[model samples]
Target: MEQFYTDERNVQILIALLKEHGIKKVVASPGSTNVTFVGSIQQDSFFEIYSSVDERSAAYIACGLAAESGESVALSCTGATASRNYYPALTEAFYRKLPILAITSTQDESKIGHMIPQIIDRTVQPLDTVKCSVHLQTVKDAADAWDCNVKANKAILELTHGGNGPVHVNLTTTYSRNFMVKELKRERKIERVMTYGKFPDIPKGKIAVYIGSHVRMSKSLAESIDLFCETHNAIVAVDPTANYTGRYRVPYMLVAQQSIEDENRNPDLLIHIGEMSDMAGIVGQPKSVWRVNEDGKIVDRFQTLRYVFEMPEHLFFEHYSKSLLSRQNTYYNSCMEKCNYFWNNIPELPFSHIWVAFRLHNLLPMGSVLHLGILSPLRSWGYFPIPSHIEVYCNQGGFGIDGNMSSLLGASLVHPEKLYFGVVGDLSFFYDMNVLGNRHVGENVRILLINNALAAEFHLFKQTNLTKVNEIERFLSAGGHFGCKSLDVVKHLVEDWGYEYLTASTKEDFEKVYERFITPDLTEKPMIFEVFTDVNDENEALRRMYFIESSTRYKVKNAVKNIIGEDRMEIIKKIIKR
Candidate 1:
């Protein structure tokens, strides 16, 4: 008997669903089983595919891209060993709340217990780490496979649409290429629009817009919020990549919250966006507060007097601006006025790192993507204003430099046509230097290394005590061959490694070098810009920064404490006091 329906449509259904969801990026590893689905995806020009030779990097690259974009990104690999390769990234993504969709090939269900070559507990291997795992059986079992696909897609959307996190989808080969295209098309639901409820009355004056570590929200939202702030004369302090300061145009950020208290400015309202963990300790308690969260969950880190877990900030501001009345206050303006004075009186140092970031922000191509490493480079980006449209990514959720080059390479793979920049420290670049060899990465990606010639962060410790210099020098031995930093070695990297290198010794040199690097010949492959600085001067700047932020010194101390974690608080206490 000839069957009227076929299972071949399932893959189309799932891929079509992904396309409908605006998931334009996919990271894939070479595998035999996923050939059909990959072929289909390739045929469709809607989604871009980044092929990674290493499955582990493939998964983390997907994690990094989605984390940066605040959306769901997919990674595909074969079953068994290939699936196992994604575990580390899966755990990290789960904990960090990055939305990573993964697909793995599988053996037929009939061979489940027959000791098949690539068979393991596929359904349960990452059960503990993933939000949900669906065993997509077969296209003939449309009731089962499509359900899993829809559920997996929904989980990703829910994870990211809320606070931006990761989720896993375990797709089996038997179901990958099968779907009842007609039926699935009738039920497809894509693109969810977030809406927010009304926030409480704003204080007539003294409102502060404090931006935390965040990505997402439309440009229209920023403009509306700016208008509201302008109308109310609110003090807007933005964290890195918030695009908050650009609209305000004043030095609208404080390096430390102690600065706010030092200036004797307390606020009636503390409207916060994104993660508050970093700023929670400093902002202290607010008299009244409101938070806009995508997931509708309330987090009272400061135990503020009031709470509102509205939808995305953009939706909230859009609604508020239409109905809410503006209230101007003197205290808010006074607080901002002092912030203005601080900016005007910024100490004339030899050269500040923020100046470097400010210059790069302009030099980088407009509408480009920047993958900023989590250490000094990320901190500098906080003070510098970025173009509102230029997408920025960092490993701030669980900051690490171990995979700096690989992660950016993966991101570049997904969007090969767009200009991509990897902003990393010398230490970070050395850690993952091999990623530079990934043939998948080409002219689209650039490596911008801020080479201060030593561990920039450790330089701060050298200032605390001259004895720490010896300790700092020890790190140099373990991180890279000393030859890598020698002038000869750097030249070898440019001439032999096939990377176009540019070095900067002075502030003026850096500005000119950066301008040229930013305006690259897009027709050619990506280039690397290695900006060199003096190790001694870098340390001096950090020491001065610490002194300027002594009241908030506990922030750095807490980071050190986290090394031992809560279990060894007693040990951390002794070290802090020492």
Candidate 2:
């Protein structure tokens, strides 16, 4: 099918394989060793190639493309330190379960370990962060390079498929230039199979669906489910695990289980799609559970969990919506009335979780990709309901906060039109401040920094004799602490780097600053909104979010108790209350 240079056959074979597998984009930075690979791709018209001078930014841009398309994208760099520059993006791709194939062209084997220029161990450099790491032993022989290409392409597919991550492939310049290409075809027709199995031919009553994080359930699918559920008067329950809320007119799942004593409101058939639900306990026990998964395999994480594995959620929805039970409408009004009664009673106040969510959700522009930093802000955002158009992305694969700025920035680079909004805590933002270095950052990138001044997530953990100090002091003493006192780093980012900067010190400031921040007008340069709050205050505010006073009410209490102990909870309470 498609062809490249015959002399440098390995590069051509690899390119053909990649193109065969539906890879149509490549991001690259100019490097000598990877010249042949880059050259071959340059002349080829099948794939679009973007050139970024900085390898780090280029890798991140590639990541953005992969994240946007949910497909495998490639990044290339020459061997040694130049290739190693892709570390941040590789780590990000690994953690985010993104499919980004990084090809590093290394120096010849003879040039190894002799203090050669740009000749570091490319194979071992990104081992920890990449799903697969392969070093082509020899490329002079056609078989060796061909085998490398085949193996690398397979690894790329494996890393990307089944909702996994990225892979790394390293090759020497000799292999790139000297390898021979045999006759190979490059056409793959991928057919999506939709399957539906028979459910028990019984009347299904109140039905509920729960979706989890990192699962790629699109807005259309969610809306369809919402419509079907509403039409059938089915008791639908979508948790934060679904990563979608407020799409429906009525409240779906009771996050805190405030009040639902009615018998008809409970779920009869629970339809769970995507990942596992974060919330374990819920309103009413289910009669039977049916799991509609795209992956096909019935992976029972919970030993006692009951379900039937189905294929292609859309087909399942299409068939089920038109089923015999379509005419039924249960006590949906009564259930809604009950839910409304409780939700209306929920006090809307300043600094509350719902209040904050409402405020930010309203403040943020529609169609913004919310880049959530791990820990409190992420949990708060999860609990805080947002609008439908806002797409949420976080490094949940590894759950690491080391590269939030870099990851979002990378995504922003690729998608310049979308508002790349980030909600990150102080510590996490500071951890990856190096990402702010003069790199390619597109306009419309807004980072909302929810600064609590410390690692508030760990503030609830019990402090023994080993650690007995205030949260700030404890954080300062930690080896990996990255909290900045003077806001000098942020100032540098704003004033020196020419980033549109906005800072908020209080709730009033937050409201005022946010009002102007999310404008409908498109602007160049990324913006950062650094909203400051005390750790204890944030904790108390978030705790009161759920209206119900049960285990969740005492969760914050216990967390504080663990962090400051029982003796200090009273003091901390007094300070927060004041």
Candidate 3:
């Protein structure tokens, strides 16, 4: 058997880092400088290599592979103009935000000014083509190997950090025909940990735990987080999709509704857990953020990430909480006060999507699951509190309206004994309506479709930029896609698919029929409760909710103005609003 491997320490380290990061796909173009790299990786069973003679075509092939597989793809080429051939495809990948790793092999930098074959400067204007670039020098000692390892790790990680994009690694080879090493050396793995090898010291100040869209936590994990918050005088900030039913749960809507003068609400240390959250802007920014996730990549969603703890969240919290001294509950109390203030003063809403959610809040059975559609439904339900036993889920990872209903149906199949309620907009419900005809759907599923006849998200002032544009309804809002203001087709289709269809257009109609839809015993089949509301009422209800949470100065001015005559208070009200 032919011993197929490279003895070059830097090339071996680069390949080791690529395998460690789970980058398996390689598109190798014909290159003499990269013979050691291409030859070494080809013999390894960990990588899947594709041959492309043209460097330009190989770059595009890597792009397609990365886009389709949703994984990072590496492209290798020789030095000089072969590396230049990658510019067109790299520029395309940069603008599209695709993760492509461009590995260009070249001769030593000392030969760049001389008349050496295939020697070119690869560092000229690097950021114009890729997000970052790293130079891996030939390793001669342990220090050189360590430096190469660090640079290689950083170059691979930059492919997905902050946002996904292409990155470059220029490897200098000496053209040594040393292929005698049968096995690679054990490489050093660099783990970036905040509290390395010991418990973390809890900072004494306002600390906030912001949980994003996550699945239901285990009881042990939840208890550990709860104890951590209690011991440190921290508040757990959660949106509806967080599904954290612990004692320290504080909905982020309360914080968003408050005025900026309440600076005490800001956290000195914000600890982030879980995945992407739709309430990024709604939650107040922290002075510094410490992220805890298993992936261990640096994620600066808040733009103030000071530390990243790479471990299981439960282990980190349980260990850190053990080192804490009991502190005064100033932060927790302040957050709860604002939450209670909003809970007590919730205005009576009209027959809108939010109104329906509020009316059905208490009726949702315990030990059930609620799946909210993106945008409108998720935002609406985030304002209210759910029962501790009720688990919440949303497709906020993609944040698209495409798979809401289908995902709810899939969840219902797995937990057939538990009740599953999905609240979606009309566009979302109809887009995945074919899932209802599948044979696997059970009677435990209940869908609440809020048909506003258009994409109402476009009209929200806080959510979209199209609020100021003319004819927004025609193009951006996707108006008239599912038919205009008619549920006859929907009713006929659902009834034919063995579903019990219910429609409620007014408050009285909703009150009479909502109880039947929510009752598990009464619903013999999967039900669709279609509620009709217009865009104007929906927008007004949102505005009214914000007004209810307005600053004390605005509330006092409005109260005094309402007490006096309407005509005299108009100008003062405009000034106060401004």
**Per-candidate count of clashing residue pairs (backbone under 3 Å):** 12, 8, 0
Best of the candidates, TM-score: 3
Candidate 3 lDDT for residue 195: 38
Per-residue C-alpha lDDT of model 3 across residues 101-188, encoded as one tens digit per residue: 9999988887887888767877674465798888999999977886787678777877877678999999989887888788787664
TM-scores, all models, native as reference: 0.53, 0.53, 0.66
Assess each prediction's global lDDT (C-alpha) against the native: 0.63, 0.63, 0.83
Candidate 2 deviant stretches above 4 angstroms: 1-198, 201-205, 214-220, 223-232, 239-266, 276-287, 301-303, 308-310, 324-355, 460-480, 546-578
Name the regions of candidate 3 deviating beyond 4 angstroms: 1-191, 194-200, 258-260, 549-578
| lDDT of predicted model 1 | 0.63
The number of the candidate with the highest lDDT is 3
Model 2 over residues 153-210: C-alpha lDDT tens digits?
4555556455667788876566344333443444221222235334443245776665
lDDT of 1 by residue, 156-259 (tens): 45555555555555555653333223332433442333453334556664566676666655667778777766566665665554445335533344434323
